[model samples]
Target chain A: MVKITYISHAGEARLVEAASGQSAMEAAVHHNIAGIDGDCGGVIACGTCHVHVDGTWTDRLAPPGEKERDMLAYIDNARPNSRLCCQIVLGEELDGLVLHLPIAQH
Target chain B: MDIAVSDIERARSIPLDKIDVSAPDLYLRDAAHPYFARLRNEAPVHYCRESLYGPYWSVTKFNDIVEIDTNHKVFSSDASVGSFVLDDTTLNPVEGGIYLPNFLGMDPPKHDIHRQTVSPIVAPQNLANLEGLIRQRTRGVLDGLPVGVPFNWVDRVSIELTTMMLATLFDFPFDERRKLTRWSDVVTTRPGDGVVDSWEQRNQELYECAAYFQRLWAERAAAAPRPDLISMLAHSPAMRTMSPEEFLGTLALLIVGGNDTTRNSMSGGVLAHHLFPAEWSRVKADRALIPNMVSEIIRWQTPIAHMRRTALADFEFRGQHIRKGDKVVMWYLSGNRDDSVIDRPFDFVADRPRARHHLSFGFGIHRCLGNRLAELQLRILWEEVFERFSAIEVVGTPVRIPSNLVRGYADLPVVVHA
Candidate 1:
């Protein structure tokens, strides 16, 4: 399991152990973490799975996909770190990762 | 100089020409193009003058139709005006019995009130409140999909997501979730010979659910304040005193909208990717473009093809005179592909800068009440698609819907490789 942290817009820090190979969305959701909603079952169809990554991790991860990026643009509170958790696949190499949850998701 | 004859001049007061182009009963799935072009240029608002519905005006141009749909006061949605979907001789006896109330069918004060009833439930806070639960719900559906198997993605995923979401919103029993979805599909799966068979039995379906909702409302109304749709409808300012019939109408609207609209979008999103594998690659390489792609996909595949309106008063638009009480069909399938507005209107662009401007959600006072929900569902869906499936290569030819009013695929088979 990889150690994943979620930072809410209010800056509340919550840490959870996410399974290796599971998307960051699964980790936040598996731990019942607040603020990440993969509403379309990771089909990248619903924007509810939005989360922002730390600047450090944001650059390290693969950029958001065309569909993901397009969706983020429509998000009400998108940010530079804005990432759909479902798009972030967890792996052993990246044991330490952080995502910031927006205050709301439309 | 010769002027075209008014369909009314031929014989029927209501004109029979519209049947060829606007019949909701007849399937126009693979209609020839020259006829459409003629409809577009020669008679943008001319009566079909041939097929089932007869002589009803077909609004073919982009801005022209949008203008009409936006001004709901002048163009009434009352079924008395005309049922939004067309009707044709192809309809059989059983086709006459099935019924459903989509929000698109309601007009004005009633429409406004019905929409407002659940407006708060879809508010940003409400979505935020359900974030964790939604994520869990999505994960559960994904987990249930049979891996390494080529199943109907539309059934397994698209319908499944929205069905569960509807159940959660209503706080219905999870066991009965699929039932609601099935009933909803029967109501709005587009008119077809195959679908027509099942739709014949849909009234019984509605009556059955009406009883269930009646009981749920009673139980929930007695309980403490809650956030589910049932609780909201019980205490909502706009809906608290609604008659049982009106309540059922709104409930049916929510279910139909929540089910069919998003499912079409889900299937469309995948189809766009397959049709344009390069953009799919760009998405695979850089996922941030998913949102833009979603909007473009909606634009590309206008799931809800056209909404019919009845002229309340005599009005002339674009030099064409329309009579009061005339049936006017808003051809959105044509509008979305309008050349004047969207460049290369036929091609799917992943990073379209003005994707949101598309009129799929419609425009004006009666615009889509669930636009936000549809977008939310799609955003999450793309995120998931980017996560689980490496690609969605079409495995077989998709079966497009036959109804002129609903432009979508009845079945889209795709191979999903992990």
Candidate 2:
């Protein structure tokens, strides 16, 4: 199991343990975490599952692909650290990653 | 048997150049599969030099479609280039203009604001509130079906339920609900193809519809805020001051959006079960799979076959030089069958893991607003169906709608076995 923290738009941080193969978006969706809509089910579409990766952990993860970046560009409140959580596949390396959710996904 | 084999062989031998899946007659016969298959294999981004809607490019592969749908800079949904379909003809005085002022045809900040204004109607909390009403209505419609006899499922179940939902959303008179369906058909149908005698007639009918809705708008505007879509629009700052033309256009958008997508899916789901009994059996055996099954059905059916977007500027896509103001048709029907992303794209699997990941609801900012609501309606419908009927058997060949868009049945003769 891999542990990750999701900070909601409301500034509340919640930690959960997700399996190695599951994505951070899936974990949030499965647990009904606030603000991670994941409406497209992680297809790199909709861009509803956006999250701001903590500055410290940003270097640890691989950079988003062109498609993911394109979707990120359309999202509101997209920051330099913003990444679609659906694209962030959970693994042992991401065990302690932290993500912050935006106020509105639309 | 020998003749059937030869027919299949003959279908296979037809050259890719001879195949044009855009013809409505193919869909009328429910025979677009082989054409799309050949196109996907031979040319993912196939071009048709001449057709009814004139020259247009077909993007078949899954990845290519996503690339086009996401990159709105080069490829645009703006009304100036062309409306969201191949046919740019409109009865309005302005040639090659979008007849409606809906956000679906607009780009950027304008689209964002209008879409945001109406987004609350299908928000999660609102859907949760609507769950009970949808289930109740589904039960009513199912319980009233004619059992053990051939009945038009399209009319009896699909159209009835969807029209009811549309009326509720618009706060239109429930008794005159069929008018909503008629207006939706008028808005989407190609004039003089039997839906209406001519564009003049279609415009008259649409004007009648606008007059009716205008009255509703007047009533809603005077009353306090309400949850219905008309009231929502009446109360909205951005939409409240829309001109009559803009009002009619927005109404067309909401009416068609609320009508066709789910109505056709309802009929398509029944037809799918008939074509693939094994998948139906899997769904029947485990009701837990209903949610995923709903997504799979939408993907397989793809109620709306394609959405056309015109190029705003010249851009190279999938090795094709798409020039400025070119009509590019993203065949959702073709992309849903793309083998690269979806395993065994031909087969209908109820519990496919990536079920919700389909191109039916489109992608990006303009994805179907009522997607979750459509899913909820289908899920509750199946649950209620399972409790009441043993099976919904298709007794005769369904008469599919003869259109490149709205890939659905016109008359599905079905018999329920309780």
Candidate 3:
């Protein structure tokens, strides 16, 4: 299991232990994390699963793909550190990942 | 049961290659289910050589529809090349038909910019602000209804609530709100479905709609920016300079997008509850199920039956050879019922898991902008409904609209028992 920290827009933080192969979205959804909707079931189609990766860990993750970038471009609160967590697969390499939820899912 | 059996029999009798699911009458009779079921079973990527709208390919399965919807690069919704509906004439006018160009029909870059301009109005913050008002209005409407007597739910409740919501969105004159309803109907209805007699008449009515909005636009434009859609469009640099046709198109899109889709779903929930009383009872017994039930209702209604896209270039999709410019209609109605994706696809399960995952809101960039707002409206409507009435019985046969484009009702005679 990989440990990840999810900080809400209100600064409330929750730590979850996600299986290595699953995406951050899958884990958050599995844990019934309040903010992440994962409405498209990890297809990167709906922008509902948007999150901001911690600056410290942002460099560890690969940049979003073309489809992910296009979907993110339309998100209301997207920023340079923004990513659709569905694209972020949990692994031993990113065991102590920190992510921030948006004000709300569009 | 007789209708279902006959529909299946008729659907089975037709040759696989000859089945055309675009006929308006099929939806009018609510008999399109068996035909779509056959398509999903036999030819998920089925093609019809001809129909009132002309030859088009129907993507019936849920995954196939998702694939096509997300791949906007290959399957374009640009109105110039074609349109987002099987009838291209609506966007590309011929003689009597009007040219209505809006963001929904445009491709990326342009579609992205224009869509972003007004999307904030339905953003979560704005929705939170509007929730109390929506709930209050819903209560008002519900309190006014005559209980234990059959009335057209479509007119009395669905139309009334949705129209009032649209009026609030535009800050449209409250008394004149029904005009928004009329304009929405005009935008979707073709000649002689009872809304208008001919395309010329439809055009005339639409121009009146345009004029009415233009008057509002002039006022809103001259004033400081406000929260209403008209004010936002007037103030936004990206939208203010839209062409007259584009202005009308944008208004039509917003009006219908905000109006008809939710209206049908409100009526649909009543119908679904009537058909599936057990599920309704489950919801009433637990108010927490309201949100999930809203999603179920939208899926069951599949308010906007199909969305069409034109292939940008020749491509092989799901092993079928689709040429450039071929009209591809993603049948959301069929996709929502695909048993492979949805367990017991026909039954309305209020607490169904992953209820938010459905095709009612088309996938990708052109997905419905007012989705959350629509959900808020339905949620409020049902919550208020439960507080007032123990049951809403379908007292008479529901008369469905005869259009493949809009799977809706003309009348649903219902009686609310208090």
Best by DockQ: 3
Ranking by TM-score: 3, 2, 1
Q: Mark the 10 consecutive residues where model 3 chain B has the least summed lDDT.
A: B87-96
Q: After superposing candidate 1 on the true structure, give the runs of residues whose Cα lies further than 4 Å from its correct spot.
A: A1-106, B1-19, B23-37, B87-95, B98-104, B143-148, B189-192, B196-200
* Model 3 misplaced stretches (Cα beyond 4 Å): B1-4
What's the lDDT of the predicted structure labeled candidate 1? 0.70
lDDT of 1 by residue, B248-360 (tens): 66676778767777888888888788878888888777888877788888888788777777889999887878889887878777777777777887788999865765767
Q: What class would a CAPRI assessor give candidate 1's docking?
A: incorrect
CAPRI tier of model 3: medium
**Residue B31 displacement (Å), model 2:** 1.8
lDDT string, candidate 2, A1-106, tens digits: 9999998877899999999989999999888796776756677778879888997898788899987886775565679999998889999989898999877565
Model 1 quality (TM-score):
0.71
| Model 3 C-alpha lDDT per residue in residues A1-106, reported as the tens digit of each score | 9999999999999999999999999999999999999988999889999999998798889889999999998898789999999999888999999999999998
Q: For model 1 chain A, give the 10-residue run with minimal summed lDDT.
A: A37-46
Model 2 global lDDT (CA atoms, 0 to 1): 0.82
DockQ of each: 0.06, 0.29, 0.77
Residues B308-409 of candidate 2: C-alpha lDDT, one tens digit per residue: 888888878767788887889999999999888899887788999768778998987668888878888889988888788888898887787888888887
Q: What interface RMSD does every candidate have?
A: 10.3, 4.6, 0.9
Evaluate residue B246 in candidate 2 and report its C-alpha lDDT on the 0 to 100 scale.
Answer: 79
Query: Of models 1 and 2, which has the larger DockQ?
Result: 2
